[model samples]
Every structure is written in C-alpha cells, then in structure tokens.
Target: MAITSANQLELLQTAEAVAREKMIDPGLVVEAMEESLARAAKSRYGAEMDIRVSIDRKTGKATFTRVRTVVDEEEIENYQAEMTVEQAKQYLEAPEIGDTFVEEIPPVELGRIAAQSAKQVILQKVREAERDRQYEEFKDKAGTIINGLVKREEYGNVIVDIGRGEAVLRRNEKIGRESYRPNDRIRVFIKDVRRETRGPQIFLSRTAPEFMAELFKMEVPEIYDGIIEIKAVARDPGSRAKIAVISYDNSIDPVGACVGMRGSRVQAVVNELQGEKIDIIPWNEDQPTFLVNALQPAEVTKVVLDDEAGKIEVVVPEEQLSLAIGRRGQNVRLASQLTNLDIDIMTEAEESARRQKEFEARTALFQEALDIDEFFAQLLVSEGFANLEEVAYVEIDELLVIDGVDEGTANELQTRAREYLEAAAKAALDAARALGAEDSLIAFEGLTAQMVEALAKDDVKTLEDFATCADWELAGGWTTVDGQRVKDDGVLEPFGVTLEEAQDMVMTARVVLGWVDPEELVAQSEEEAEEGAEEGASEAEA
Candidate 1:
C-alpha cells in the first residue's frame, strides 16, 4: 500500500466511518492515522530520524517530513536528528540553538508486515479513544437508575449492556434469589463508575437502598417534583424494606403520596424489587418520634433515646414484642438503619424488670458508699440520687426536700460521702504512683484520679503520652471487622469521656506541652466552621 491520490480520500472516509461506528470524535481517529503513518515512516527511513506525518482534514493529503533540531555544538546527542547552530546555516539564514529544520520526504511504502503494524496501532488508539468516551459519558451518571439487557453471566456476575457500554452486576448486589438469563431486561442503579487500565468500569446494583429511592422518585410525582422527599431508606434486599419520607408542602401527605391512589406507586417499586415488602413511614426531626413511625404495626409503649451513643430503646407490650422484633430481628434492624441508631426492643414487662434491677443496684451503691440503712438508701434512690457524688455536692435544700431529713442529717450525709470519695481518690492516686505515673499526668486538668490510674494501667504515664493518643483511643470506638462491629475499649471510656471531649483534652495537653500552636488551632477551627457553613448553604439550596 502506498500514499497515492486514489487512496488519499479513503483515509478520511475510513476515519469518519470508524468514529461514527464507535461513537467517538473523528478528529481522534485522524490523529491515530497520522501517528500510525509516522511510525511506519520511521521504520522505512532511518530509525534515528524524527519522521513526522500529517493528513489534511479536507483533502486527506498525507504529507511526510523529516525534522531535525539545532543544538549547541557540545550538546549534540543524536547526529541524524540534531545539528550545531553553526552547521544549521543550510536550512536558515540565522539558525538558533533550539530551532527546528524541516525538509520534505516521500511517504514510505507499506509492506505486508508494516501494514499489519499500522493497523494494530490504529486499533489501539481507537480503543483508547473509545474507553475515554465511555468514561466521560458514564462518570456523571453514577447514583442514577438505568435499564439494561443482561448480556451474559461470568461466574456469579451478570454482565449487562447499558446502551453505550457494558456493566457488571456482582452477585451479592442482586436481590435475594433473583436470577437472570441472557437478553433479560433489568433495571439497576449505577452504583459507581471508575476508570481503570482496561476501560471504564460501571458497577450496577439492584439491592442498594438508593435504588428503591430512585424508583419511588420515578413513580411518584410528588417526590419527583420536590414536594415530598425520601429522607431515608433501608432494605433487606428482596425480603423487606423501610422508607422514611417527608413533605415540604403542608397539604401533601408524604405517606399517602408514596402509597399512591391504590398502593400503585409503592407497588411499582415493590414489583421491581421482586416483591420486597416496604413499610413507608413519615419522617420527623425528633429521632424518637421518627423511630416510633419506623417500627410501624407494632405499638411502642415508651421510647428512651441516648443521643450521644446513637442508641434507642423501644418498649412494647409483650404481645407486640414479637411483631416489633419481627422474624429473626429484621424489623428492629431495619428500624435501626432507618433511624441511624442502635435499637434495643423490649417487652413492657422486661423494661419494668430492668428498671427495678437498676433501682436496686443504685440503692445498694448508696447504702454501701454512704454507710446508710436500706430505707435511707431506697429513699435516696427514690429522690433521684444515684451516687455519693450527687448526694455530696447537691444543695442542702435538696436533701431537706426528702422526707425525714433535716439540715443536720443532710450535713452528716454530705460529710460521710465526702470522706468516702476523698479516701477512694487518695487510694487511686497512690496506686497510680506505684505504677510509675508522674505528677504531670496526675496533675493534668480534666482527668480524675481514677482516669489517671486507668491511663497508667494502659502504659500512658506522661503528658506527652496522653498528647500522642488518638481521640478514639481514649474515648473508645466501634471497628467493623468482617462486617461485625467490635468494641475497642478505651482507658477513659468507662469514665464517660466522649470522643469530642477526649479530642479537646488531648489537644489541650499538646498545647500545654508546647507541641501544638494555639494560633494554628484557632485558624483551623475557623476554616472548618466556614467550610461547614458553606456546605450547609449548598445543601439547603439543593
């Protein structure tokens, strides 16, 4: 094959045809042709020479040229491609060191091997361009719903043709017992799009909670119009699910809108999910109120929430306990997910027994610590005094409010409580010192003697050690191992140190030790506050 006038126009035609077939830019194909021609030209001409080729976009005329650069006499490396500034006078009137001298050259004749090599180069370039096109088209389509046809099954994964590209749906992402064959129509959520060496990978999912939300958005006009919003979603795949929705418009009932005229809207989503039963609940700002709705069909007698711990306890009648817990604890688990809380559901009787047990335990603590009679301990517990610290530091008037207690008795009680607490603190301080704890740690503000002892037991005996500790290390945290939450016990966790408090304490220690700049900390906090305000504004607008 040769670059003759007859085949010149064919190059442009071929580029356009390939571009149309691959849905890529024709300019990319033309550039690929130019590169392939240049590579073949290099093979025919001296390999050391810089042979270049360009194809005219309109005329399709292939022009070949050999380019050489003018370099300093002492800096010349490639003799065929570079020349000294003084030796470059033949190509220019006044050649500079970095000037390029170009001369026209005839196109190379492509033999069988050279033609095959050129074809491979063009194919490789076209493939790269196709991958780039696919990535650009699908990257922003993530977190959306798309319909596709199942192409084939690879191992346990199903490959689907998603219009312009193919996506893989891992088996675990499929609804329970959902099977697909070749050419089966499937709707999937675009979970993610990633660029890799092979090409762009589009991950599809059918079991994602977002998939259900998207389905509702598509089927319900109120949701699509922003009159109602899906606040949260929790799915047990094809078995059961719960969705929380809120209405911005006062007249529009979010639950009624999602449930449709005759359960049509929700049924559409349920049909697509392989008959997954969905419980739609109204969203509320109060977590306990929201959780009560989330548990649905089961009457809750009482709700106790621990905001800091992100946990909730729901008390239901004994008959409703089984329904609230559902089959294998699925109901409560879904409720927990919907509310973003750890839920502990108990029968009314169980809650009563637990309360009684706790009351007994507190009474015993007051009895032993204050050296008071069982009646006095029970009275103290009944008066909301759980520990000696409360009994010791509370106002004398509060103790006077209790029946059969005067000012003298209140003073005596406070005296006993103070003596016991001081004795305990001294013993803990002595124990910490015996374990090699320094005064720097013991004297640190915010840490009690028991906390210092705990830190000493954990081998943290200095202010420096405390400063180097991570907040989670001091406040305790949950770690996910093999999909299970494992408790990480912190030395100060039992002392009721929250993560934020631990962070503040550690940073304070660092500041006291002169290890951190107070000014930088202030600047960082201001920057974070500005960022958070900006994010909140953007979310509100959205």
Candidate 2:
C-alpha cells in the first residue's frame, strides 16, 4: 500500500484501534509499525545501506532516510555505510570525521509479500504486549481469591478465564471430586503467576488450606475485622477439615462466631467446598489443652507430652479410641498437623498398664543400687523418685515431704547415692586412662568422668581424634549418614551428657589441644628463629 497524505489519518486510526483491543500502549503499536516499514524499505533500497523509518504519531506521515558517517580513508570499512572526508565534502562544507549525514528517500509502495510481513510483525508485537499486561495485572493477586469462568480442559487440568487473563487449575490442585464444564463460573485461589516464553501463566488451586481460610474471611465478619483470628487450618479436602481460632475480645467466642447463628457462616464455606465437613474449635495457648480441643468429639482422659521429641501421648476411654483415631487414623493425623505435634492415641487401660510396669522397674533399681529393703524402695518410688541421680542431687527437704521419712533417713539415702556415683565415676576415669587416651583429653577441663569414658570406648582416644570430630558428633546438630540427615543425639549419649555440656566439653578440648588458636605457635617459632640468628653471630665473632 502507498501511504499518501489522504490516507495517513486512516493509518493512525487503525494503530489506535489495535492498541485499544489488545490493551497495549498506542505508542508501542506505532513503533512496531515503523519497524515493519523500515524492514520493507531495506528490500527496495539495497539491504547493505543504513535505512530508518519514522511515522508521526499525530498524522501517521512516514519518513524514510539513509544514514552515513564521515570517516578517514583508513576507517572506511563499508563504503555504503561510511563516506570518506573528501566524498562527504560534496554534501556540506568541511564535514568532519565522526559526523552523521541523513539523506531523505521517497517512501516506496509496499508489495504483497512485504504487506504480509508487516501484518505478522504487528500481530506478534500485540501478542507480546497482551502477555505483559496480563502478568502485571495478576502478579499481585497471588494468594488471594479470584472468580473466573471455565474456558477449557486440557488433560485433567482446567483453564479458567479470569477477567483480563486466563489461569490454569492443575489436576492435583483441584478437589478430587470436583468437575467443571466450559463457561461455568468458579472461584479459585491464585497460587502463582509466572512469566514464561509462551505467555504469563496463572496457576490456581481449590484444595489449598489458604483457600478455605480466605473463604471464611469473606463469610465471617469477626475474622475480617480482626476481632477473631484463625490460628491454623488442616484439610483432608472434600472429606473433612479442622480450623483452630482464637478471639481477642472477652465477650466474643471464636468458635461460636465462626459457626455463626444456626451455622449460616460455616455452611456457606461448606457449600462452596462441596459439603466438606468442618470443625471449628477454640484455640488455647496451652499445648495440651489445644490438642484436646483439636481432637473434638473425642474425650481425652489424659495427655503425656515430650516437648524435645515433639510427641504427645493422649489416652482416651476404651470406647473413644475408634472416634479419636477416626477412619484410617484421620482424626489424630489432622490433630497432629493442626497442633504441629506428633500425636499418639491410646486407651486408659493401656496407659495404666504401662505406668505400673514403670513403677515396678524403678522400685527394683532403688532396692539393688541403694542396698535398701523392699519397703524403703517402695517409699522412694512412691515419692516420685525415678533414678539415683534425683536422690543424689535433690535437697533433703524434698525427701522430708514423704511420710515416715525423717531427717535421719533422708541424710542416709543421700549419702548412699553419693557414694555409689563417686565409685562409678572413679571406675570410668581409670578405664578411660587405661585405653590409651591422651592426658590432654583426659584432663580437659569441661569433660566429665563419664564423657571421657564414652569417647575412649568409641576409639576417639587421642587428642587429634577428639579435635577433628565434628561439632555434631561432639555436641548436637544434624548429621548426614547414608544420604539421610538425622539428628545427632551426641557422641556422649551413652554417658547421659546433656547437649549443652557436650558443646562446652568440645570447645575446651579444642582450646587445650591448641587446635583453635594458632597465635601461640606463631610466637614460639619467631622466638626460636631470633635465638638461632644470635647464636650464629656469636660463633662467628669467637
């Protein structure tokens, strides 16, 4: 097409319409048109010549020109692109090297093939602009709820047409029982927005716990207004779910508020999730109480907690075990996830049997180790004394709290406990010394007698061996063994050394063996060197 003055306004109008439909800046569309026309002009006027095209934004008047730089004879690598100083003088007076000259060329009529190429270029640019607009619009919407229409289905994934963009709901992220047909309206959680070569990809999810939380926020005014907070959520998706909530206001009940009057609020969320059962429970600051609430509808008789191991043992009535464990252990599993603790559920009968066995074991230990009668051992065990260390380190007042345990008996028990521990420690120290342990390791200030023996037994008998051991082996950290990272109980586990004590012992051993500080060695070497130099000078003078 020949761009005459009469049709220049038509060209500008067409560029504006394309930019409006594609949601791109009008200026960018015009720039793309200029580039297409420039490529066409190069076909007519030798491709080797430097050519540029500019279309006016207001009138769409096209301008074509050739560009050449004035250079010395030696710098003229391409004669078509560069003109020698003498040749450039013909166009103007005394044209200097490095100066550019623009020669105007009349606009050429585009042929059929050239017109087809220009159309393709404009479409490509428009598609790129559309992708950029979609990314900018949806990037910040991730982690929030979005409403869209089902556009199509690919394999098992659903493509939803969100206004101004399209998003994919992968099969794994969809609720197992949910299905969609084209043009159906759906709400989804914007999981992520990624910029890819093909376009901006928006990933949506219906099964994420956050999606349920956001739905509650929309339905419950208390949650949205910050009067109540959803502390945690656990979902078995389309089957059952649990949410723990706490109220900041004294008059408002978090669980009741979340359930709403006659279950209106929670039922709205449930209907959206296709009849997923939800249990809203009040959250407690105390862990055991929180766990008791998390396992709702199941009565908990007792809870025993091990904080270090992140475990909780819950005992329920025999009739309640099935309910507490749920089908395939679902209830306890969800409770574990909601509280972030490992939950082990058992019956009251089982816990009582285990407790009795433990009491008998402790009674036997006290009778044999302290040389006490069965009655006296029973007395100690009844007072909650489980080991000799507690009896050895506990105050006499603690023992006096027991009936029939007078001051005289308390002193005698403590004396026997001390004597037993001292003898045990002395034997351990002698054994470590006999095992070829270095004196430096044996005398390390922080190592207890038992820790030294444990090291010796493990063949870490030398100063270098102890120094080279990893902090995790000496103290407590994660250690990799056979491609797995496992928590190190510490190399001194056999001796019952605590993690803190093990760390201190490792630091002391390194310091004593001179593995940590090299300044002293450097000083000693310098002193020896100076002394040798003085001795050599004295010998020469003599």
TM-scores of the candidates are 0.95, 0.72
Cα RMSD for candidates in order: 2.0, 12.8
Candidate 1, which segments miss by more than 4 Å at Cα? 72-74, 481-484, 510-517
The residue-by-residue lDDT of candidate 1 on 447-526, one tens digit each, is: 99999999999999999999999999999887878744577888898888989999999999999999999999999999
lDDT (Cα, tens digit) per residue for candidate 2, span 1-542: 98789888877998999999888899888888888888888888878788888889877899999999999899788877789989988886879999889989999799999999988988888888889988998999999999999999999999999989789999988987688999999999999999999999999999999999999999999999989999999998888999999999999999999999999999999999989999998999999999999998899999989775566999999999999999877888789879988788889999989888998899998988799988989889988898899999998999999988899988998999999889988998999988877777777666777788888888988777887776667655555576334566667765555556665566556767667665765686699999999999997885
Model 2 root mean square deviation, Cα atoms: 12.8
